[model samples]
Target: MGSISDETVEENADAPTYVPSLPVPNVQELVKEDPLQVPDRYVRDQDDILQVNDMSWLSSEIPIIDLSLLSKGDKEELNKLDLACKEWGFFQVVNHGVAKKVLQDMKDATTEFFELPLEEKNKYAMPPDDIQGYGHAYVVSEDQTLDWSDALILVVYPAQYRKLKFWPSTPKGYKDIIEAYSKGVKDVGVELLRSFSTIMGMDQDALLGLHEELVQALRVNYYPECSRPDQVLGISPHSDTSTITILMQEHDKHGLQIKHNGGWVPVKPIPDALVVNVGDVIEILSNGKYKSIEHRAVTNESKERISYASFLVPRDDVEIEPLDHLVDSQSTQKMYKKVVYGEYLRSSMKRRMEGKAHTQMAKVET
Candidate 1:
């Protein structure tokens, strides 16, 4: 764990107190009111909405990694994981230790919270200049194109960082489920990070040891069915700034897609499997040996889709850059500039989600 320092304090002070987003119509409520007529702001230009119907371009199914095997020190599974990160930047993990009961309870709680009366759900609405609570995120302008989704986003780790008031209480066991769920997913993330460090020929704990307080945030997204699904997006294409992100999709619904081979590949939801992806921070740390893939959510015409995404990030004070050993390799160079994690976050939260723009900001000009 990293020790506190004066530099950390200064960096935190400069970071925005809160990442605010513009208020957007409650997409769930709006769809209920008029599912057939999408607001002009919600409709994107034809060019903005990429057609993903060309299934032939999709590569083979996203690789699946067995956490159970990895935990047992199975070398073959470890190699598969390395290949998954390098080639696909995404994978599904089966037998991930998150309990089935915990997953179900949280999924139920999320659905119940979203089904609450609009007024009840709005009780925890995103405040005037804060991204926490419920509503759209990264909606920075009045004219900004809107996504057809609503989300409850909250920092769920390190105890003190959690905004309990924004946590849903309407669902009787919501808070407890969140606590249980976060702990389980965090365990999974830590194990994965350790495995990553091992893959890099470093001590298993080397990477995670950079921060005394790693941050874990949860975003529960509710994408309502849309009449014109082809014209709207559930979420814009973007790469996460986290070290890694884990997502639990509703078992029977499919909307997640990753950009591969210059085409969009749909991710089919598997029962009891959690999808994991490499984030920009991982790419930066690995000196681009691993990649962070661009992915987006598409709106569904016949049914609503819900997903739970847990982002695991380094604490604000940690300095992030290509690890020395990775850069020292003959074939590699320092591709990204070193920056405090908090400052990187500040830059990311300031911009709307688009492709991999935020990650590119860290690249060094050779």
Candidate 2:
């Protein structure tokens, strides 16, 4: 589908603005209540929660197959991997060859960056315009109330881009460590994309060529130890806007949740495994074959949680429309605008800052 510009709706002009309040409950008080009891506002029914717990049934359903096996050009295995990509946009990748030490260092560096004092964090807080740094939800505008979490965002692609311009100057080694991690993650992202291409029944070089100048970014999220973990969520439900997201989780923190068959499923972290999810772009490219799942994170009662997400997106110059090969007489082609990814990102940021609903914005024209 092509992108479409949003048509302004006057009815929303009178709606009350939502400003999020940080709920600070005493640790002792939280332990008294059910550690998993979400606040009334965030309370999801047992059925919904059970769906999350039912992930085991889908085990062997979603394989954490090794990509290294496919590099040998095994046609049968490659075909299976392709089916997995089309049917399940999510996968657990092991033996993809990212160094364990590097991954650990990346996690440590992220924690160190967020642990810096608030004032130091504020230096890199996203500007009202760019919306690319540490900040509370709805910092620029009030759409939905703020989510309970803090994040450090950096853009790292095209090889010649600037390092995060706004970051804490403390923790002397933070910058160097993060930069190294970013480079490593970028390399991994490229390799994974190549694998995805083969799975899509296309030559690896063909897909890489199409996305030669892809836009890649990293978001380091910190969910502070919450006294009332059940009262609030680390992040609200939303679909990622990139092509794919590769996530690394810190030890002992459980917060990532995924949506499957109309339910939220917790994605328990596996040591040394990177969590991968498809994004809107992939859904478009695959012509409804692969889904861009909706997922969110929930907080923990005692331990603080941290996660690193590497987003791989198309270059700003690339036109985002459904691939022609994905359409046929049996599948009607949907028309979206042929907008540039950069414009879409900028517009989306502006809409978010204005406290406007993301869905209200125009769809990307094909």
Candidate 3:
């Protein structure tokens, strides 16, 4: 299962690039007009939940790894992480070494921003066809099923790409808090990817070297209390398009759910832990050895849950594929076509706008 790269042509360093996609109009504005109830426009008829016949899948637990142990290169811890990557595709980390103050302030910042008056918050409303700023992403069509949440989305990495207008300048120290939190998570993400290289028996720097021009996005999701929690989803069921994602959520509220064996399972919150997920990009990079799990968020009846997700992605111009070293006909087959991040982004926006799984477009046929 390890040597699948020979069959395909050696990858070219230069890949074609495409213009990035625009996002839908800010749906958060709509939320302010009618905050208490789910609007007809946001109500979805299609069931996003995966219905299951066998109830046993709920017993499958999401693994928790200690990042401190991973940093020390402990073989046993690395083995546990490898299993988590191959089996669950998601895990939680305690003692990850990110400052507790940074985590708390980041959460506080998300809450205070959402608590602002709608008019105040709308100053940085996402532009049409743009994915950044405060707005609902993928609300591309009038008929799309809207999520039951408000989000402050912004690009965090490569300082040049950041749009300060949307960064919430009104908060006394919002930008500083966000900057520290973003840097902390990025440090952790890089280490996590390094460990993945070891797990796959590749050069210690194989994956990180391929993705030097790193990109990241900060998605602060606010899931408000819904009168009909059962009738609406906070976010739809879909796999992440990025290479990896690190998430922080409040310990008391549980809204994230992962689809497992045709059933939805809730992700319990653990204090001071970051939830890491292997994304679709990583699946392709590993020749499908690691997978991107389908997950979604459900609404709460009483408490509002705020989740801070830092998406780790490569430059859109970078080419993504199964690394040559990871492929072999024995087990690790090249299951996807080489993908340019810009093209992937455009397709993702189009599919999400139309409410479809965009990641499928990158799959290679046997």
Query: Considering every candidate listed, which one attains the maximal TM-score?
Result: 1
Off by over 4 Å in 2: 1-61, 137-140, 330-332, 335-337, 350-366
lDDT of 1 by residue, 82-125 (tens): 99999899999999988899999998888889999999999889
Tens digit of per-residue lDDT, candidate 3, span 1-366: 321121232222342222233344344454556657677756766444435332334534789898889988999999999999888888998888899999999888778888888788888777664667777776656667678877888887876666665677656678878888999999999889889889988867777788767788889998877767777888887888888999997988888887666677777889899999988789888888888888788888776789999999888778988878788778666788999877787778665532226867778877
RMSD for each model, in Å, please?
5.2, 9.4, 8.4
Off by over 4 Å in 3: 1-36, 53-60, 330-332, 353-356
Count of clashing residue pairs in every prediction: 0, 20, 10
Residue by residue across 160-210, what tens digits does model 2's lDDT show? 443345544456656656666767667767777777777666788656677
Note the Cα lDDT for every prediction shown. Answer: 0.85, 0.62, 0.77
Which candidate ranks first by lDDT, i.e. highest?
1
Displacement of the residue 60 alpha carbon in candidate 1, Å: 4.9
Models 1 onward score TM values of 0.93, 0.78, 0.88
